[model samples]
Target chain A: MAVLTFLLRFLPFLLFGRKERPSPVLDSLNKLLPSAIIAVLVVYCLKDMNFRRIDNFVPELIAVAVVALLHLWRRNNLISIGGGAVVYMLLVQLVF
Target chain B: MKAELRYAVRQTLPVMIGYLFFGTAFGLMLQNIGYNFLWAMLASLVIYAGSMQFVLVSLLAGAFNLPAVILMTLTINSRHFFYGLPFLKKFREMGKAYLYMVFSLTDETYALLCSVWIPDHLDGKKVRFFIALFNHLYWITGSTLGALGGALLNIDLKGIEFTMTALFIVIFIEQWISATKITRVPAVVGLLCGLVLRLILGPDRFILPALIVTVTILLVLRPSLDRRSGEKEEEGSSVPSKR
Candidate 1:
C-alpha cells in the first residue's frame, strides 16, 4: 500500500516536474505505495458514516479548525498546532 | 530565519487549515467510538494518517482483528503506493529516518510534497526537509489535541468526518489550478479510475482499486510520459543530462 502511495505522490514530479531522480522506478514507487493501500481502507469508512459517527466526528472538525486558524495567525510556527489542540481540549472538555 | 519560517508556514497554511478540521474531527469521532485520549493520541502520533486513523476507531470499537486491520490499513493507505518511487534516492540519502518519514507520510503532506519544487540551491535541502518535518509535526499536534478533545468534550460531533473529504477537495482545487501539461493525464486517469472503482467495487471499496489501476497504467506508460517530458524539457532548457 505504501508503495502505491509513494508512486502516486511522486509521479507528478516524475511525469511533469523537474528533479533528477536517482532511480525513478524504485524510488518513486516506494515513496507513494502507502497512499494506494490507504485509498482502499478509507473507502469502507465512508459507507458507515452514520449520525453516531458524525456526532463523534464533530469535535475533531472543531479542533482541526482551531489549529488551522492558529497556523494562519502564527504564520506556521507549529507552536500554534500544539497550542490550538490544547485550547480545543480545554474548551471542549473543561469550559463547556 | 524569520522570513523563511514565515514563508514555510505560509506555504503550509492551507494544509494546516485542512488538517485542523480533519484532525479534530478524527479525534471527536474516535473518542465517541469508545477509545480514550491515550489511544487516540497513540494512533495520531504513530499511525498519523488521518483517514486510516478514523477507520481504526471503528475497528477498535467493534472487532479489532489482525487480518481485517491489516487489510483495511493497506486499502486505506494505498495512496502511498507510489509516493516516493521517483524520489527513492533522495529519500535514501535522508538516511535512517527515511523509513519513519515514510511511515508518517499522509495525503495532505503528500499534497504539499507535490507543490513544492525542491530546487538545487544550497538552502533548498533545508527548506524541503523543514517542509516535510513541519507538516508531520502539525499533524501530530492536531491528532493529540483531537484525542484530548474526545476525552474532554463528550458532546455530539456531527458531520465531522466530512473534514477529510473537504480537505481533499481543497487540495484537489489547488493542484488542479496549478497543474499544466503533463499533469492532466494522471488527473484524468485517477478520477476516472476512482469513479469506476466506486461503481464496480461499490463505495466501500473503490479507492484502493482505483489506485491500483492508476498506478499500473502509469508504470507501464512511464517511458512514454518520460519521453514526452524530455521533449518538452528540450524545448525549454539548454541542459545536458545523463541518468
Candidate 2:
C-alpha cells in the first residue's frame, strides 16, 4: 500500500521530467491550479457538514464566517486561524 | 544554512500546531483501536498522508485485503498528483533532494511551497527541503505523542480539527484577494466546481472529480484568461507577495 501511494505521487514527476519542456497549456494550468486546489481543500475541510441539524450547522457556519472575515480584515493567516479556531472550540464546547 | 533552517522552522510553525493536533488525534484513534505507539510512529513515517492515515487505522483494524487497501490509498491521494505539477521544474532542479520533496508533498507542505517566499540570499532548494522535512517530523512527533498519551491529554478536541479548515479558508481568501494580476476565474470556477461536486458526489468522492473539472475548465478558458491578464504579468503582479 505504501509503495502504491509513493508511485501515485512520483508518477507526475516521471511523466513530465524526462521529456521536452512542458507545453504552454501545462504552464497555464500550473499557474492557475493553485488557487483552484486551495478552494477544493476548503470544500474538503467542510465535507462532513450536516446542515439538517441546527446545532451541528451553526458552529461550523459561525466559525467559517469568522475565519473569512478575520482573514479579510487583517490578512494575517495566523490570526484568522487562531481566532476562528478559538471561536469554534468555544461554540462546540460551551454553546452547542 | 543556519538562516535557512530558521526560516524553514518559521514557515512550518502553523503546520506544527495543526499536525500536532491532527496527528495526535490519529494516534489517539490508533490506540483506541488497540495499536501501540510503535504502529502510530510507523504509519506517520511511512503512510504520511494525514487523511489517508486516519482511514488506514480503520482499514487495519477491520481487514487485511491488500488490493482494497491499495485502491483506497490511490483514491484518497489522487489530489497529490496535481501538487507535483507546479513543482516539476524545481524538483528536477533539486536533483538528489527531489525524492524527499516528492515524499513530503502533503497538502499543507505544498501550500507552503507554492506561496512562501524564500529569503533573497538563502538557497531556495534548501529552504524547500527543510520545510518539507520539518513538517514531516512535526507530523511524526504529533502522532507518536498522541499514541503514547492521547487519552491523558484530557482536553476536548472535538472542534480542534477546525484549525486545518480555518487555515485553508484563510489561504483561499488570501489567494482570492492577492491574485489581482490573474483573472479570478480560476478561484471562482474552483469554488463553484467543488461545491457542485460536493453536492452531487458528496465530500468523500468529490475531490478527484473537482480537480478534473477545474483543470478542464481552466484549459478551455486559458486563452481568454491569458488575453485578459497577460499584460499584468510583466508588471510583476503575477508573483503575489509572500503570505
DockQ metric, candidate 1? 0.10
> Can you write out model 1's per-residue Cα lDDT over B1-243, one digit (the tens) per residue?
555565567667656755666676677677677666676666666666766677777777886587787777666665565455444555556666565555545665655555564444335445556666777676666666776763565654434334344334334444445555664556655666665677677656666567768788767766676677667778667655533
Model 2 lDDT tens row, B92-207: 89989888899889999988888787778999999999999999999999999999998899777778888888878877887877777465778888899999999999868999
Chain B TM-score by candidate, in order shown: 0.76, 0.91
lDDT of 2 at B130: 94
User: Could you tell me every candidate's TM-score relative to the true structure?
Assistant: 0.62, 0.93
Instruction: Tell me model 2's lDDT, rounded to 2 decimals.
Output: 0.87
Q: Please write out the lDDT profile of model 1 over residues A1-96, one tens digit for every residue.
A: 233434444454455334453456644444333333233333433334333565445555565566556554553333554554465455545544
Per candidate, native contacts kept equal 0.08, 0.78
- Candidate 1 chain A weakest ten by summed lDDT: A36-45
Q: Grade the docking of candidate 1.
A: incorrect
Q: What is the C-alpha lDDT of each candidate?
A: 0.56, 0.87
